[model samples]
Target: MTTTNKNIENIIETNMMGYASYVLLDRCLPSIEDGMKPVHRRILYSMYLQKAFNLTKSANVAGQIMAIHPHGSTYSTMVGMVQKDRHSIPLLVGKGNFGMYTSRDLMPAADRYSEVKLSDIAIDMMKNFDKNVVDFVDNYDGTIKIPEVLPVKFPAVLVYAPSGIGVGFSSSILPFNLAELCDGITNYLRTGEKTILVPDFATGGYIVKDEAVFQRINEEGFGTVRIRGKAEIVGNKILIKEIPYSTTREAIIDKVVALNKSKKLQEVTNIKDLTGLRGMCISITARKNTNMDELLEKLYKFTPLESTVSANMNMLVDGLPKVLGVWQTIDRWLVWRRESISRGLTYDIQKMTDKLHVLRGLEKVLVNIDKAIDVIRHSPEESIDFNLQAEFGIDEFQAKEVSNMKLRNINESYITKKIKDIDQLEQTIELYKEILKDESKLNELVIKGLEETKESFSVDRRSEIIELTQVKPVKLVEEVQDYNVTLHLTKEGYAYKFKGDQEPMLKPGDKVIKVFETTNKAEVLIFGSDRVAHKVEVKDIDDTRVTSLGTYLPNMIRDKKIDIVSYSVLDKKHKILVAVYSNNRIAKINLEAYEGSRKILKNSYCLKQDLVDLITLQEDTKLKIVTDKSKLTVHTKDFNLTNGRNATGVYASPARILKKVEVA
Candidate 1:
């Protein structure tokens, strides 16, 4: 039994290791040779096999992919190939919605609803499919053969900037401008001098220029760089033309909305995400007398107007994961290209040499056409090749070609036409052999290819680089100017605010309950019957400027059913919250106990039955609790409420079920 258990343990360990290696090598990470993960390579290979070069349903392409890679998410990965906004050089040309970087909705249409075909660059990469350059391997079930890695002519890894996550490793090689990359590579090959490289995202933004960060990334394989959105003060408004990479334009708008709600962005009047089909364009209208500089700073500080993009540059090198920087990665690519081209040249030379031999033998046959025809006509088919070889002093292969020809085509004109090209073909074969032997000649060829690729595929850099510098922090609104105001709320949940002794907006049963004086930056705590305590900024309430009809607290809370039981301006002196349940019981907690990033406090105070009312009690505050039979008056001044957390309180009347509460 112990031996069996040990064998089971060994099997489990082997299987687990195999799974990890598969994920790290074949599944998650891209190979450095072709800059393609296994699934991506399989999809393109399947498309090539199926002749899916024309516009066809994406589902059809996906169905073709499933013959080799039935990974259940072929459609998703295939859709990503056509997301022009996400990839610098999209691999596929999709006819339907492939999603954009500006919009929050990233999901594409179903595969059956979209049409797709391989992009020009993808077709170019596979142009040498039949060439003996790249290795081919049996696919998942050994049903079909596919290229192990594509014989890519250009630096696909740098152009595509593929990113992935795997077991204990990840890769994030940011994209660069193809033209600049080609130039840099050619310069390095010629001069052996390295050039500093930076990322240029398809979603255009400003990358902060940090020489050290970029140097580390190019030299050491990892670094972080900050990308800032482009925003400028245009008249009274700020126009944002571009945003950081990896963050949607809608995300910045949402952050600004949240900041404005919390009163941190009170100066931003109208925030509109006007990002259209052209590019990212977000417009922000600032109020008059607003500190424009400070508003812009706040936008950057509080939102994803600026974000970080990290480059890890981890990838598979020969079925093993390794971290490679720009210099080393390009160097490896150059090596692969040289070897592949040499292999291609060698393959070409052998075929051309054999064709030259066959042409020469045919030339010899036409020299004595009548004798060749007599040898073929008289001799048996098995002995014809040997007879021609014996008579013409030629080998079996060349003689076989001479004997297999049609009698009419074995005439002078057709034979001469075929043999006339032997001179040019021999010259080409010699040139291929020379190129294979000469290293500089091979490099020159590679450079020529790079130049051609640049002319064909390179484009203008999308992201601009800016010098990194410390930015001045935006001053708080309260620090700029403190507007002292007195907050008032009626028993019917109407809220009002005023600076001086203006008569409060009043109606029947709506007596004004004045709270302590505070600034516009102050907060008001509103206790709802739903047992939630919501903290609203005093400026947000003051902006309403409600009158006798009043800003209804329930309307502000956005829930008409949550009747406001009690509300008070939160000052340091008033530090206790007393919650009254329907059981005539009272519990107290300090107002500071609810301080957090979130505004609403739910289920924090008591887990008892219904929370009939919540009261933010101050010194000298008296409450009259009314029951079915009699009224119980309790002065909160006598209650010791200076505690940080919830505290138990005695029942005012054990027999009474408290129905309502009012200030006495």
Candidate 2:
């Protein structure tokens, strides 16, 4: 025998694909036909089979379900959590502490402590099991059979939404009101109109209906919705009556305490949770100076009072995972339902046909009572059935039934009852046949069942949908008014601003090299030794006392040992400027090109060894240079404006060292 090694990538791919298929099909995703995963379906089926619809111990139910589901702990928790949920029509009615939706920490007691029973709604999902409406496959041990999917009479997916995380995909479907779901199905069937659905959470909250995402969800079956806890400010406290769907009383209190400790919730002084499993009630006391509205907004910003619910309409379609739109899901469900109902009717018709055969055989016996008695009394028991079949033109099954018939069944009154039963059975057979043949009749039956289910399980929508107004963003810094201001810079590298107009108070060694008049709204540019230009907004420079030293130049420009060579106030009307470097290079460029914020302005330019001076200039303007050795002059048109700030310019002067450059 020869042994071969498989490629590592191929092995990994095969393993991962198998794992994903298991997670998607058996664990996470629900069947669209029944809206239940295998575990949930098994739990319900076990209860139905055991006739444990009364208050059966949850542990016993779990034990029964383990025959089908191997993992006891996980299914126990799932059963406890799902049964206690008050939002949709619960599949199981549970007693005792079945945990809660508000707090994940408060887990329900061990399954032995909790009692559970199936609800009427859950029974309806398996209504036609005995009638052969759905297919069943062998159980895990092959000891028994289990349904592949329930023959659900109505749409359970929309009413009781699913949320699960899987291998590569997950789903978070929101529950809707039962009445609305029924109406939607009816309307969709009647006029081919798609019904719009909104989330109706059991833990009542407010939904921002005007959000564009909600509209997209209704149209495409995937989007996000914003939910806020119901809150009101009264007196000195804000009372939250209900929190978001996933939020809990304990969690909300913890969040508030954490926010308060961090000072993020400035107005909140104390927090308390008076919530129970029934509903939410949280009270937060505010400080004396708190603005109630702003306090609530802060809470919403920092706490779980507001949250988002995502919609991902992923389910099993034809035994494959697929994301469907809203109408597409409804349409597919209707088709499945039509087929199931049709199969059920066919099963019923066959049953009636079988009964009519037996009745007709009995009718023959009634016509010839004496011959029937002789055939039954004198004929050998083994041959009696064959004799009866031949004599009465009946099949083997009917003949066997006659041979085994009791004496009471042969009386006159019993025969009359058989005749009436045959007539009724014949009528029932015709009705079932008609229902199967006509499509509209089938649709009407579906509509009727949906309406009846809605009546049995419908409740007022707990979540309120409202068009929330978009809140404007608040600015962190206040706006400043424009006013006349004077800027002064010294050769010693001191920069200051004065209100109105004032002369710089310079020390004996210091000299005021540049003084400019600009408004508070103006942006002042500083040329540095590092071949970079820095900008400062005039409003940021506070007015200084005449006797005090000005703000250090390094603090303003972010460079040390660098004196201000020249400074200019950017003007909207004048976009051109000229720069002269100590290396005797001169360039003409747009002033707007150098415009940047205080931090970013440093990298805006490149220079030679040092910067000589920069001046605001206009197009077609001429420039002059006064050098240490000599003077050189040229027209601005001698060179073109360079687009890049780092570009070294053409020489404006022949002198090796230039002292100053100015407009001629």
Give the candidate number with the greatest TM-score: 1
The residue ranges of model 1 lying beyond 4 angstroms of the native Cα positions read 1-3, 7-11, 475-664
How does model 1 fare in lDDT? Answer: 0.79
- The TM-scores of all predictions, comma-separated, are 0.74, 0.69
For model 2, where is the 10-residue window of minimal lDDT?
471-480
Clashes of each: 0, 1
Model 2, CA-based lDDT: 0.77
Off by over 4 Å in 2: 79-86, 470-664
Clashes, model 1:
0
For 376-453, candidate 2 gives per-residue lDDT tens digits of 888898999998888878778878887887866766677768777888999999998999999889999899889988
Worst lDDT 10-window in candidate 1 = 542-551
lDDT of 1 by residue, 1-664 (tens): 3543458788888998988888888888888888998888998888888777899998888887888896775988887788877777788888987777556865788988999998888888887767688988998899888898998887788778788887677889878888988999999889999999888888787898999999998888899988888888987799999788778878888888887777677777788877667766799998666777778877777789989899989888767888988888998889999998998888888889999999989888878988988888999878999999999989999988887877789888999999999999989998998999998999998898899888987779989998757788665354634587777777777667777756565767777554556677667777665567777767666433435555667665546676666665566556667777777777666777776555667754566556666666555577888876788788776666645333446576655688877678
